[model samples]
Structures are given as C-alpha cells and as structure tokens.
Target chain A: SAVISQKPSRDICQRGTSLTIQCQVDSQVTMMFWYRQQPGQSLTLIATANQGSEATYESGFVIDKFPISRPNLTFSTLTVSNMSPEDSSIYLCSVAPRLGNTQYFGPGTRLTVL
Target chain B: TQLLEQSPQFLSIQEGENLTVYCNSSSVFSSLQWYRQEPGEGPVLLVTVVTGGEVKKLKRLTFQFGDARKDSSLHITAAQPGDTGLYLCAGVGHNNAGNMLTFGGGTRLMVKP
Candidate 1:
C-alpha cells in the first residue's frame, strides 16, 4: 500500500472561491485518481490524473470546475474552482501502484462551502 | 456505466451479533473489494475477491463473491463495537484506466455495546 497524504485536511471556503487540494504519494505511481464523496453518499470519480498528460474528467465532471495537475508521478493536485455549497464534499486522491489493480487513498480533504 | 447497489443502507446491531451486507450489480465485475471507513478518515481496504464463487476470510470477517461475479456479500461474526463504520463495496471496471472502480451506495453500520 502506498502512503498518501493530502494537505489542509479540512477547509472552509466561501462560494465563488477556489481551493486546491494536494495529494502526495510515498512512491511514484502512474495512475492517480480524484474522487468525491458527498455527505452520506458513495464515492464518485471526479478525474484521472496521469503525469505528463491532461487529466481525464469523468461524466458530469467538467475540467473547468475540477482542474487537475499531475506535475510528477508522486504528486497531483485537484482544484475546485468556482465553488458552491453543493460542492461541499470530501475530496480524495487514490494511487494505483504499478504492482496491482488495487488503489490506496489519502485521508481526504473535507471542504465546506459557505 | 456500471452501478452497484448495497442493501440495508443502514444497519444497527448489538455487540456479539452477526450481520450480512450485500452488494449487487446487474453487470459483472472483474473484481470486487470491501472497505471500512471511519469518520474523518479514508476507507481502509478489507479484502478483494476476484474469482467467482470465491470466499476469503480475514479474522472474523468473511467475504464472498457470487458465482456470476455480479454480486458479493460480507458477513461478520461476533461483531464488536470496533466494527462500526461505513462499509463500501467497489467493483473493478474494465476501462482505459485499467482499475476504474464503481462504488456501491455504501452501508453505514452502527454496533452498540
């Protein structure tokens, strides 16, 4: 399992602002994914971030709203732009290491949009 | 697009009781994984069942995959208050990403001592 960490474990932001969540993995990985878990809901894939390429957003998720950056194999960032109350959710980053089909997740960034 | 439906959306049981949680899907999955999540923390993977009709046990928790690969079940024996948490079932999807996961609605379990 990879040791993953997300910065600013929790945050409070006003509507219309943006916050960038960083995910750092202990080892270099090729596949990094961002997922959102709404209050009392399941996890939904927001995007797939691969280093040296553009992030692929999932259905109903626009790149404009959830911009992602995979600057390196071990680090990625997801920026929630133009936030709204509906965007209040736990944002998590997962890494699929080179060895297996399993993924390891970060503690998650809990965002509260006011 | 595949979807996984979890049964008994919420379960509250007393300690020492046994309970089962189900995850069903109309579409087959290449693999299924079970995870337990506590407040303010990310889900911790419990077990992964790949082959159909396979059963794996971890301590007091048992995980089984259906023969058709479209369903799975998790049974815990002699449950303890420490077992209380949100249980999630995720199926591995065949996608370009290779390991894309389709998560179930999730079962929130509360065990009272």
Candidate 2:
C-alpha cells in the first residue's frame, strides 16, 4: 500500500475562484487518479494524471474545468478552475503502485464553493 | 456505459445484528473491489474479488463474487458501531484504461450501540 496525503483537507471558496489540491505520495507510482464525490453520492473518476504528460479526463470532464499536473512520479495536483456551487465536492487522489495492485487513496479534500 | 446498482441505500441496525449489501450490474466486470469510507475521509479498500464464484473472508466480513462476474455481495456478521460507514462497490471493466473504475451507489450503514 502507498501512503498518500492531500493538502487543504477542507476549504471554502467563493464562486469563480480557483483552488489547486495537491497530492503527495510516499513512493513513486505508475498511475495517479483524481476523483470527485458529491454530497450523498458515490465517487466519479475525474481524470488520470500522467507523469510528464497531459492528463486523461473522463467523459463529462474537460481539461479546462479540472486541470491536472503530474510533474513527477510521486506528486500531482488537480485544480478546480472557475469554481461554482455545483463543483462543491470531496476531491480525492489515489495511487496505483503497479498494475494489478490495489489503489490507495489519500484523505480527501472537502471543498465547499459558496 | 456499465453501471453498478447497490441495494438498501440506507441501513440502520443495532449492534450485533447481521446485514448484507448487494451490488448488481448487467455488464460483466473483470474484477470487483469493495471499500469502506468514514465521514470526511477517502475510501479504504477492504477486498478485491477477481474470479467468478470466488468467496473471500476477512474476519467477520465475507465477500462473494457472482459466477457471472457481474455482481457481488458483502455480508457482515455481528455488526459493530465501528461498522458505521458508507460501503461502495466498484467494477473494473475490460475496456477501461489505467484500471479505471465504475462505482455503484453506496450503501450507508449505521450501526447503533
């Protein structure tokens, strides 16, 4: 299992503002993913942060809205741009150390956009 | 799109009672994983079932994968207050990239003392 941590454990942002959540892993990983969980709902994959490359986003998500940056193997960031009330959700980062290994998640960042 | 449907969206029971949560999907999955999430925290993986008709046990928790690989279940015996959390079921499909997961609507279990 990998030890993962996320910054800004919880935050309240005004509409139109942007917030970047950072994910740090204890060791290098091959894959890192970002997920969103709305109130009273299950998690949805937002994107896959690829090292030194553009992230692969899901169907309903776009790069302009949830931009991701994976500068290195152990760290990544997801920025919720132009936030709105609808964007208020718990953002989580997970790391898959290798193929066929279980992904470990960081303590999520709870964002409330007012 | 493949979708997982979990039953008993909300379950409230007293301590020591037994309960079961079901996750069903029409599409077949390569593997299925179960997770438990507490308030204000990310989910923690409990177990992963890879083969069809497989049954894995962890202490009081028993997990079973349907023969078709399209369904799974989690059964807990003698539930405890610590068992209060949201249980989620996720499936890994053959066509998904990077082992992307499709999640089921969670089952929120609250065990009273």
Q: Taking the candidates in order, what DockQ does each have? A: 0.70, 0.75
| Clash count, candidate 2 | 0
lDDT of 1 by residue, A1-114 (tens): 799999979999999999999999999887899999999988999989978888888899998999999999999999999999999999999999863468888999999999
Local accuracy of candidate 2 as per-residue lDDT tens digits, B8-110? 8999999999999999999999999999999988899999999999999999999999999999999999999999999999998633346778899999999
Which stretches in model 1 have alpha-carbon errors above 4 Å? none
Q: Which stretches of candidate 2 lie over 4 Å from their true place?
A: B94-96
Model 1 interface CAPRI class: medium
Candidate number achieving the greatest TM-score relative to the actual structure: 1
Please give the C-alpha DockQ score of model 1: 0.70
Question: Ten consecutive residues with minimal summed lDDT in candidate 2 chain A?
Answer: A95-104
Enumerate residue pairs that collide in model 1.
none
Q: In model 2, which residue pairs have backbone atoms overlapping below 3 Å?
A: none
